[model samples]
Target: MAEFIKIYPENPNDKEIHKVVEVLRKGGVIIYPSDTIYTLGCDITNYKAMERVAKIKKIKLEKNTFSIVCNDLSHLSDYTKPIETKTFKILKRSFPGPYTFVLPAVNNMPKAFKKRKTVGIRIPNNNITLEIIKQLGNPLVSTSIYDEDEVIEYTTDPELIYEKWERLVDVVVDGGYGGNIASTVVDLSETNPIVIREGKGSIEVL
Candidate 1:
């Protein structure tokens, strides 16, 4: 069973945060809350953990790309190609909120992502997950967890998420209830930014 940790959304406990970071650092996959919904995440550098997540999602990583969650904008260039001035401004305005921007990726990505030409990046406003990413010293591979049932849509209750994903993951951080909606997805890989999916974020900033 996954270790369930209840963290205060407003004020996250450092010790609990460390526990989550440790798990990620040790190649453990976790189900955690974001500003939009509860997400499945693992250390971006952990190829095996990424494989585990891919297996759980029934996805082939080569065919599907996962959005990477960074604590802030400082390390975005590490994963993506050089950002143009306009793109930087747009990112500055849109990030630290519920938005995922798809940008041209660096050629030298992990083996699983070598075939991917673009990558989605997010810097969520949620504090607990941000702090966890900050301590982990790298981005986390983020993918929204969609429930199999149609009625619930996206699972919001942490306890229920744990119950459903406990055996499959290593940790489940209970950061109170999460939202059903996902982050707005904007494709910035082209000359013009396009709103691909309208969700929690407002397009006015774009």
Candidate 2:
């Protein structure tokens, strides 16, 4: 059975937040709320935890690209190559919101999840999620809480999520229903930014 922890969506209890972080540190997969949607996350560096997330989603390791959730813009450099000044300006204005930028992965990135030397990175504005990342001091491997077929399962109730995917994931952090939407995806691997998918964030700002 998956352990479900209730956390304050805005200002999560410090004790509960610590417990959630402990689970991540131990390589446990957790379902947590993000600015855009609820996500399944684990320490990106933990190969076993990453594998568990992949297995639960029925995603082939070779076919799916995983995203890293950084606590802020400064953390982006840890996982991806340096962003150009112009691009950085644009990102600074729009990030900490619902947007994912695909950039070239840094050389030190873990090979288990790197694909074509690129990775998806984002810094969400959610408090609980951000606090957890800040405490961990590194990004977490994250993906939408959905099936491989691209079906989205959005809910705020922990019991509902537990009843549905209890066996699939290890833990559930019930921060409440994040509005049903995925992050806007931008491929910045090229000189020009391309909007691959438009979700919560508006394109006008990008």
TM-score of each predicted structure versus truth: 0.98, 0.92
| Model 1 local distance difference test score | 0.93
Model 1 Cα lDDT, one tens digit per residue, 31-59? 99999999998999999999999999999
Q: For residues 96-193, what per-residue lDDT tens digits would candidate 2 score against the true structure?
A: 88899888888887756655488888888899999999888778988887533345546645667778777877788888766687899998888988
Count: clashes, candidate 2? 1
Ten contiguous residues minimizing lDDT sum, candidate 1: 59-68
- Residue 36, model 1, lDDT: 96
Candidate 1, residue 7: Cα displacement in angstroms equals: 0.6
Return the top candidate by TM-score: 1
RMSD to the true structure for each prediction, in A, is 0.8, 2.1
Error of 2 at 82 (Å): 1.8
Model 1, residue pairs in steric clash: none
